[model samples]
Target: MSDSPRTILVVEDDNIVRMLIVDVLEELEYTVLEAADAAEALAVLNNADQTIDLMMTDLGLPDMNGKDLANRAREIRPDIPVLFASGYADSVDVPEGMHNIGKPFSIDQLRDKVKGILGN
Candidate 1:
């Protein structure tokens, strides 16, 4: 019921994977922001002008892990939904209501998971 399209902040260090995810989310009719590392992600989260509806990050990042980033992002936007993506996601301790989709996911898999969180 929001007037603006839902916005997602995608954090992935892998260039190709990040691009693919961005493309998929855009096709799903969501506005997207992206970062290649935790620092950039933090900067975006710190921005007072942007409204991020959700965060989808790779579990393993070069600067800092996705969980930590999510924690920090929560400081900026409490209750922001989080989605983690990784091959080893089984090992992650995800927050309640948080979601995950493994790497190499099909377009449908990605769409379902993101739309489920965004409620689109």
Candidate 2:
């Protein structure tokens, strides 16, 4: 609700994928925070000076799954939107209202998903 760019926390173990996501989001004028694991994402969420608008994380992480990360994030920021990115979408059953996009997603697809989630 503030007059600032919306922030998105991206968590992925794969460095290339993480970089791609961050680059795409940043190109779209979003404030992106990157983390390679759940612990790092949690640290960002817990200490962030600004509110994160959404969390777009890979489904499988090195330490924890995306669903668990989202649950933990909600505890810290109840209203934060979650967008799960996974190659195995059929395996992930997120709660209703949560957004998700499959792996190998194009930039436009990612952009649309993020915009929809943020109501842009």
Candidate 3:
């Protein structure tokens, strides 16, 4: 394994969900960074030196939606992958070719999706 940790930026407004995703990522041996909304996520993306291996964000945020956040994040880092985690999976207009994890997901599902995205 590399000395530098793989970073994942998780953007979710709910505290419990945020912590759960963080825990899962940490357990999988990736470094996890968090943001409560798109603005905060942008700040982290702007400041972090390590490449964000992937981003998992909720579609419903207090400010902008996750798709918009993903677009902005891509503008800053075009190659980074994004995953949408939302209860509104059937409703939200996600960007084409982006990945997603629906709400109320199990740990196994989350792990599988993360691994699939990271190609681990």
Candidate 4:
């Protein structure tokens, strides 16, 4: 892999939640991009200059749902990894090859999940 830290695109409609996630990820030494909704997320995804290794999105987006956004993102970056965050995480049935984390996740849990997905 490249020596640069992995870049993560975080898509959460809630400004506070998005900021917290962005702060935590940045604290963990990863590059973070923020999007308040699916439309903004798509804008980032469509940007060829941006390097997004993984996407961490909330299932309850203001515009499109996380699954829809993930599908759209894949249309642009087919192999991009997706991590879904949901309040009902235990009941969420994420698609194969995708991952999910419960809302209000601890900092350790977030760190571990991202690390596991990114193979860190």
Candidate 5:
């Protein structure tokens, strides 16, 4: 990975899951931005000056669904890559070229997917 810190937006409703992802990304030396729902995610994206390198979002949310959030984020930041994490593997239809990490994923799996998306 490059020495420069990459910014990652994590939109997850589950507090534990969100924190786990934040911790992992932090350990990998990436700057992490967190959102509990789509609204917060959009707010963060709207206020961000630089491009967000990656986004890891849960498929289900209290507000808008993660897939919709990802779509909206893509509209504003087309270059940013998205990774959807969900237990409902068969339910959500992820965007083309986007990535998905099943709910019970291992740390290695998460790391590999993020690395692959960032082209590390």
Candidate 6:
């Protein structure tokens, strides 16, 4: 593992939900970048300077769905891990190499999910 902390990009349309996720991730000692919508999230993904270890986006975004955003993100960063957050996590059909977590997840769930995806 690298010495620097792993960074995660969080994309959610709901302000409160996004804030809560960011706070929880930060508390878990991961560097977090936040976006309110798909456009913002794409902007971050397009920036070559940004070192994002993983992306956790809400399935229901104001502009685009999480799956679409993840597709575009994969185009930009081919190997980046994508984690989808949804109220209907059990029903979500994430493709291979992608993951999903239910809404209202406990902090421990989020931490474990991220660690599992990042392999740390």
Point to the candidate with the largest lDDT: 4
- Write candidate 6's Cα lDDT for 60-101 as tens digits: 999999999999999999999999999999999998899999
lDDT comparison, 2 vs 3, better candidate? 2
Give lDDT: candidate 3, residue 89. 72
Worst lDDT run of 10 residues, candidate 4, spans 89-98
Residue 108, model 2, lDDT: 98
Task: Tell me the tens digit of each residue's lDDT in model 2 across 1-120.
Answer: 576888899999999999999999999999999999999999999985867889998989999999999999988988888999999876778876678898889999999999989987
Evaluate all candidate structures by whole-model CA lDDT and list the values in order: 0.90, 0.90, 0.88, 0.94, 0.87, 0.94
Superposed by TM-score, candidate 3 places the C-alpha of residue 8 at a distance from the truth, in angstroms, of: 0.7
What TM-score does structure 6 among the candidates reach? 0.97
Winner on TM-score between 2 and 3 is 2
**Residue 86 displacement (Å), model 1:** 0.9
* Whole-model alpha-carbon lDDT for candidate 4: 0.94
Instruction: Give the runs in model 2 whose Cα sits over 4 Å from its true position.
Output: none
Error of 1 at 111 (Å): 0.4
Deviating ranges (above 4 Å) for candidate 6: none
Over the stretch 69-99, how does candidate 1's per-residue lDDT look in tens digits? 8889888888899999989777777888688
RMSD of each: 1.1, 1.3, 1.7, 0.7, 1.7, 0.8
Please, what is the TM-score per model? 0.94, 0.94, 0.90, 0.97, 0.91, 0.97
TM-score, cand. 3 vs. native:
0.90
Looking at candidate 3, what is the lDDT of residue 13?
96
Alpha carbon lDDT at 8, candidate 5: 91
Clashes of each: 0, 0, 0, 0, 0, 0
| Candidate 2 vs. true structure, TM-score | 0.94
Error of 1 at 35 (Å): 0.4
Q: Lowest summed-lDDT stretch of 10 residues in model 5?
A: 88-97
